[model samples]
Target: MPHYLGIDVGTSAVKAILADERQNAVAEADVSLTVSRLHDLWSEQDPEAWWQAVQTAIEQLRAANASAFADIRGIGLSGQMHGAVLLDENNRPLRPAILWNDGRSFREAQELGAKHPELSHAMGVIPMPGFTAPKLLWVARHEPDIFRAIRKIMLPKDYIRLKLTGAAVTEMSDAAGTWWLDEARRDWSDAALAATDLNRQHMPDLVEGSQPSGMVRSEIAAQWGLQGDVVVAGGAGDAAAGAVGLGAIEDGSAFISLGTSGQLFVTTKEFSPAPEAVVHSFCHAVPGRWFQMAAMLNAASCLAWTASLLKRDIGDLLRETEAAYRSPSNVLFLPYLAGERTPHNDPYARGVFFGLSPATQQTDLVQAVLEGVAFSFADAKQCLEQAGTPLTYAGMIGGGSRSAFWARIFASVLDVPMVRYQGSDKGPAFGAARLARLAATGEAPEAVCTAPSILETIEPQPQLVELYRPRIEAFRNLYRALKPEFVRA
Candidate 1:
């Protein structure tokens, strides 16, 4: 009856999931978190809040199922990737963490790229403002006193691990987003680090995602009413961990994640860097594997924004859009609410609703938003295919995928079947728990990490695919025509 605990330090909340040996989640808990936007394009969160959220989430889990909690054998972590958490010598936070979506470091990102012209090739990503290196570079230039006092740097979940076990360690998958890792080599790159005025000493020791990084301290265990010797697995970035959760670990396995930001992730057996195409190439959560990714900065959040704009409940709006979703609309939307990542890499990109007319209705706008996101996924899919990761089918996860109408739109636009797996909604936390089980029992991942039973396969509509093919081209052309105006305004 031993159980494993998985904790995900997400953008908006901290989630805890408990899983037994049978691969079923026994209990789950979550604690909400807040982001600070004191200035334009700046997103910060106190690291202390993350720790409190974790404690609160664990407490809730322990209270809900005390017996199951008491039998917790190990713990695993998954977190929002690319967050910059600076720490002093005492392992105390020097400043609020810079979040993954923060765009304040855009200039620094450009500066780094200027200094290292081949950075995208070496790092397997075009350095973006949301990356750790540019954030650190901004700190060094603007907050010189605070930067000078720095002692360590950690990603979001690794910061929690520092509080839990007094260990500062990271894994390859999370580190890959830092713009400091030599992804092909699976280690930190000296040239990349030096460009940001950093050295190897500033980084945590690297481990693969399934290995044990540390053990929970006795005080934490006692406070949480858990075992004292529970090992903490080297967990993954949210993307890699989500892949593990969806059983997308094997070569050529893929999934489309429609979270706050959406991604098309494809696993590979070897390191195949495709920075020229602006796709992310990173190490996989599984050992000796890598993945190439294409992402959009906005997805479900776009729907949420549309709902807010029209002053309607999200579910109600989604329900009403079902009819419009199945029909063609002249209106098109750009799902670039927080700018874009894949293909464009332009932080200046903004959301736009084109082709609006006097006859436009709320339903039409909602349908446009759904189709816009689907088109964005199509852009990402093409990037992966051009990078040689031919995906005939992919699984779908995240909040947007929960909508059958939206899932159908994605299938039609991508012209590929979308498979929905049982227990797909558990996301990264579930994957982390599976890794925890691996760490606790010395079990082989292949034996434990198999795809869940199929829920339903969404097939593409041939007519809709043809309809979207022309619309997709128009969507790109609109972006092209409006890019200058977006920069100007």
Candidate 2:
């Protein structure tokens, strides 16, 4: 049986998965990574560390299933979106890669919006501090020496691709987040690049996410005990690839990802940009497809933080939350722990807990955190529906999908069924593996990209949906009332 490898370079860790032709994950491994926070609101990670972690993950996979790993015919990559990795003429990193959660380019982001009003329309995304364009602007202004030395720039996964293939290449899904791609055209935008004193010369060559980028380098192939000509697929950014893994590639197909950050992804047939609402319209991982996305910078992280605050294990907090599901909590939480993206592009936005009282207990606070994330997704779902695609149901992926309580809450809040699939918990890496199979065997995406077997489907509870209706409004109002204060602080 032939096998394919998929590597996902995430913010917290690098994960590798080996899957056979039948779409079963035969082996898997992960290696941890760290994010540096040297200053407030700044997140950075060394790209070198990511490459090391990838090697470690692959080694672990080889140790688990040597025969399956050696039979790997292709490789695909997926990673966190919007990170900026700058390289000098010698193919050396100029500095630490600025991460997606970094907010140091807030002023630059605002300036881009002010200077180039047409940008949002062209790129199908609002200029945000986390995008590559503003990060370049930040570097040009504050670190001119490093900026002058820059010769190539790529997103996080493409950086790993460079190490694998000796080429700097990026695909549509990841490039779409850079604020420098002509999303409708699926290529680099000269006008968008000019906003940051850069141009197509600084950007990597672009390809559709499912196409072949290049072959694995001979040296790395030999070390990994793989053939030298193994094809490398032009893998996608994490969310798009996750959609692929869920087989949510066709128009109207949608998925909700509840990872460290949360995202609601809706696939569309046309490029429908909604800049005013801060919804991202970008090319999908599959060829001849497009997608609209709404992202929240905090999701499961909020629950983890709450658990820590309560001095309890996360499992304990979740158990207590499960018991309080039927009993609605009056306390409302704004999960802007890392600011927000969809419907509000304000980087200064902070998390807030409203309606707390002396009677509130640990369970109430835990429930509030869970409900708050669900509410945020609901907000994004509303915006996406208004823009064009209406999501009546979607596949759910990531850590939060494991929580039965939170899954039901999401279904109720969004008023839609949420399907959790078997073998889908691996998220992007699993999707990347599917792409690798395509690259290796020349299989059509529609044939190979079938949805995983259903694990369970959580349908909305009518009573809970009605109960949360008013609370959704209060959540919106709280954000509106607190917007001014967020800006002031």
lDDT of model 1 at position 286: 69
Q: What is candidate 1's lDDT per residue for 347-457, written digit by digit as tens?
A: 778899999999999999999999999899888988988888887998987767778778888888999999987877778899899888888888887888788888899
Which whole-number lDDT from 0 to 100 does residue 446 have in model 2? Answer: 94
lDDT of each: 0.88, 0.89
Taking all chains together, each candidate's TM-score versus the true structure is: 0.97, 0.97
Model 1 misplacement above 4 A: none
lDDT of 2 by residue, 1-489 (tens): 789899999998898899998888899998989899898778999999999999899889989999998888899999999998999998889999999989999999999999999889989988999788999999999999999999999799999999999999999999999999998888899998887889788989988778899999999999999954799999999999899888998888889998888899988999999888788999998888989999889888899889878889988888877876664579999999888888787778889999988998888899999999999998999888778678889888987888777888989999999898886679999989988888778889999988988999999989989999999999999999999998888
TM-score (C-alpha) between model 1 and the true structure: 0.97
Worst 10 residues of 1 by lDDT: 320-329
